[model samples]
Target: MTTGQRIAAKRRELDLSQEGLGEALGVSRQSIYKWESDSSLPDVDKLVALSRLFHVSVGWLLGVEEDQEEHISNDLSPAQLKLVEEILSRYQQSSQLTAEQQERVSELVEQKVRESRSPRHRRLRYGAACLALLLVLLAGRSLFARLKELDRQYTDLANSVGNITYSVNSQIGSITSRVEEILKSQNSLVADYATNIQSADLASNTVTFSVRVVPKTYTEGLEILLHADTGDGLVDVPAVPGPGQEFSGQITCPLTDSITLSAVLVDQGTRQTQLLGNYSSLYGSSLPAVGISLLESALLNIPRGEDGLFHVRENYGFLTGLSASVSAVNEDIGQSQVKQVQLGLFRNRALLFWLEPCSRPDNHHGFEKAEQWFHLPSVELDLQEGDELVFAALVTDQYGRQIVTPSLPASRVEGDEITWFSTSFDFPSEPDGWGLAG
Candidate 1:
């Protein structure tokens, strides 16, 4: 028979459906169908796997040999063949033997032929054949009963083997499913450990942070840190553990400039930090309500120090050209409102001079704009160490009501030309005192 026909026969013998066989071979039902229809052949590895699954040799599945019985009989000796014939004749004489019994007798003869070919039986082949014929004659009916019992025992053993094989395959499938479940559970746990920022509040110069964590046990030996990038440098603050899985902390810094916040977890054992999340815009406090929109100066060309502060060297003296522009006032105030803008300079919180820029005609229809340029060629103020210089703007409306913008501070280095001029707001302790442009 062809290989496909043989495969079909073996599958039927094992009481396996096409789907069952496909599952055993790790292939789709369509693949099994094609293989059995001879439309496609299994690959070399698949052929080997099939041979092992079916408990058959690869050569037999490939149709390399004829029927198993014929193959066995081809190697039998003449004496062995004669003995098989005699036994068949005796069985045929029994009137009670049915057609099915006759077929079984032939199979028995083939089994005996294979056994007799063993080297131990080769020397007594003819003698054993004669003795077998005599016994068959003497114990005719009794001998037939014994042979039938043997066949029953063989059938029971085959059934037991099939049961054992099925049990093993079931156990293997159960183990595989359990392993997958464990892996899925582990992945779910990892996902639960993700930290999230619950809320961030900015009050004055302090920013308070609130965060949520999963699994209260995870808080043990875990340190949470809040990092703020203040354009100049990074400031790190540790969060104190609160009730349950919550953590909170606060940092004091100017909130005017845009700050980048990052949440991190530090392991107490290894002291290594793991980033949890990041916030680019916090509290929307990056810019003041009304202040310098832009400031340009030649001093900005100096390189910044490692601490993110500009360090002006001695060679570049003070009095470098500077330009400052004031952003439009509140949208409600129209340009038609009478107004005068003055730039005030303060040293050590004391007013030094008020320089007013020449106001251009209000050509723009919406709001008023003010700009001032300073080139202090001969003027030099001996700025001492630790001295702070601040710039403020005074806006007076037609009603004589004056409003002062927030102050910008710059500190002088001990021996350097200038240290740093920060764009952040530094409101004076007594706001009313600084509001007057005397």
Candidate 2:
């Protein structure tokens, strides 16, 4: 049944008039009428109050559960049951009862049951019975007041515990952050010394070392040296002081054979040596390797073929943006330093645009690797059947030597036949390079 029908049924079972329920709920009689008719619903507080007054669960009144009445009659004595039946009958005869009258009848039924079960009350006269009922009522009121106070204290205790827990968690988080910062600072202090191989020239068979002592006060009576293993025995080369906390040393050796080099600091008084950094001549090649490749273009909706080329139709409008990745690696001891990378786009053997110094190596003083992605702006191109698009990168090392990567090409497609374009091209040597105007 609907919520309204359930409310009306429960109200009738208790023989309560609409005005009586409204008065108990502190609402107008029209409100009860509207609720019973389902034209409006009671607020949450009113629903709770109605549930308590009718001695029914709120879930049942809202139709969320099946209506199940509390069976208080099972424990009732014969005389008490008869008294309840008579009371219900008298209310039905009158067709209605006020809220106050209903409450009094319910209390009278409970009092009757309690008095019948009590041995002492069973022998009491009417006057003693009346006095006992008054005492019971007062005791019940005190018990309810105590329960309410206990509930308030429990709420306060729970709130206090929650606040304390929050404060403790906040303090723990702050302490954890401070501890992490302290550990980081200690680790950095432990690694206060650094050393690196600045350059190794195979032609001159010379290797240069760079050392940095972070704590300048600890440099006294300390001699920096470069130890080299040239397939014979260890050779020690003393380092000369440079500006600030820097030191440099160069040693000429036969680098043709794979050699190992290490930088160390020696204690002049105790003759104890501490190793700093080590390098092998075979880490990377002397010449830098550069590459360029076209990444996929999501906007164009074109698929790449097995031959590694983007297949485009003849007279296709190239309005979508394109991007290419350029990478260069030269980790050799001497010429490993990559100064700059230049990228260029070509259409049919002519330069479309060239970006000078499109990318540079990281600023680690001696980094030897670089990679960058160049995003081409959206442009309109009338691509013909024999047209080809190429991307290339020019990598320059520290010694002014430059190397160009092979062209990465995209071909034009007509019907089922694919026309491949030439991947060979020369870079423009103009000072300003090339642009779309060409």
Candidate 3:
């Protein structure tokens, strides 16, 4: 059906007054009258909105049959095309305009035609010209009406589209914020879990320490220490990484004793420290898999005294005489005292047989070296009740030859607070002295 017929039919089906339809479409009642009378058309974009409102196609609105092409004529804008379709569909099922409105549109067309006569042309020419002018006026009126309708449709559609876009953007933003929040929470959870694990493990087990001494160069050596049972016992292991080299050894308990695994790397001149396979397992197991782990790894700096030499007597007092006598003339004279005395390393084995005298005052010939005894001035002692007493003595004879001797059984009386005297004597003494009387 034609767009006008469709509008008339839809108006009848809806039983709507011309005024009612005009109000819904946001147009003047006169405009609706003109549309149903076939004097004008709606604009293109309005046509599209009308099609959505009434559910149909522009071709059907334009009165094209099913066999005809569905494309609208070029004269129609997108809105007009849609309006045409809505009018058609509504006309077929629900006429929404009044009979009086249609009749009024017809009267207006006729009145306009009558006024068009003029003296400027022949009757035929004037009629034709008048007809053309009337058609032009009608077309212009239709165009204006369609433009108005489309303006209203455009505003409403734009508002709907903007609402949809805003909703989509809000949803997306919310999702992103939630994801970020979850990630942050997860990170905090992981950190908390790690801390808990560490605290739990420490509380559950006993801590033992192992040390690896590594020397960066030939001058550097590795020292490993273990802190076991709350620092009650110490083990000094015997593995060092020399300078410019690397070495590894297994950490055996009681570090003072020997271990099974050992490795040494030779360097040109400088010592170096390196990792080895055996020590790798021992150190690695210190983590979760193994109960034992190293608290600190470093190159140990051994103090000079810890080497177990250099002793001073527990009692520091002025000496009356430091002496020992040997019964055998040709036997080791100073061996007992030299062996008992503690010094730097060991008794100078080179002086294994030389006789030397210690510093002293009372001279029976200005302090002679006995094949037996050499004395030192008594040194004073600020010893506590259970303190240890120690000293080194040398014995020499007139010949100034080296000799060894056995130590006497040291004695202590009650309330004396002097005991635990250990002494050793060696057969040969270096120029200075041999052992420590530790």
- What lDDT tens digits, residue by residue, belong to model 3 across residues 1-438? 446556544453353544566687787654554455443555444444444444554444454433222222223234633543343233223322246543443454344333323223122223223433443454455444443443454344444433343333223223322543463344421111000001111122222233333333233332422112112253334444433343333333321111222223334543322222121111111111100001001101211133332222221112111223322111211111112221111122222222233433244343232222333222233333322222223333232322222221121211433432222122222223334221
Candidates 2 and 3, the one with greater lDDT: 2
Best by lDDT: 2
Model 2 TM-score (2 dp): 0.22
**Candidate number of the best TM-score:** 1
lDDT of 2 by residue, 78-178 (tens): 65446444543443244334566456645754675566466644421232235334434544453444334434543443334333333332232233235
Instruction: Tell me how candidate 3 scores on lDDT.
Output: 0.31
How big is the RMSD of model 1? 34.6
Off by over 4 Å in 3: 65-438
Residues 1-438, candidate 1: write the lDDT tens digits.
555556655664464555567799898654664465443556655665676677765556666644322111123447535744564556456535557655655665565555556655432233334434544554576676654544344334333433443333324223423543454355422222232333232323334334333333364677767666666477788877666656566544333224555456666654433333333223221111223322223223343345544443221111110112212121111111225555556666666676444333244232232233322222245555566655555554443444454232244334544544432224432335574644
Rank the models by TM-score, top first. 1, 2, 3
TM-score of 3: 0.16
When superposed on Cα atoms, how far off is each prediction in RMSD? 34.6, 30.2, 47.8
Order of models, best lDDT first: 2, 1, 3
Candidate 1 CA-lDDT value: 0.45
Better of 2 and 3 by TM-score: 2
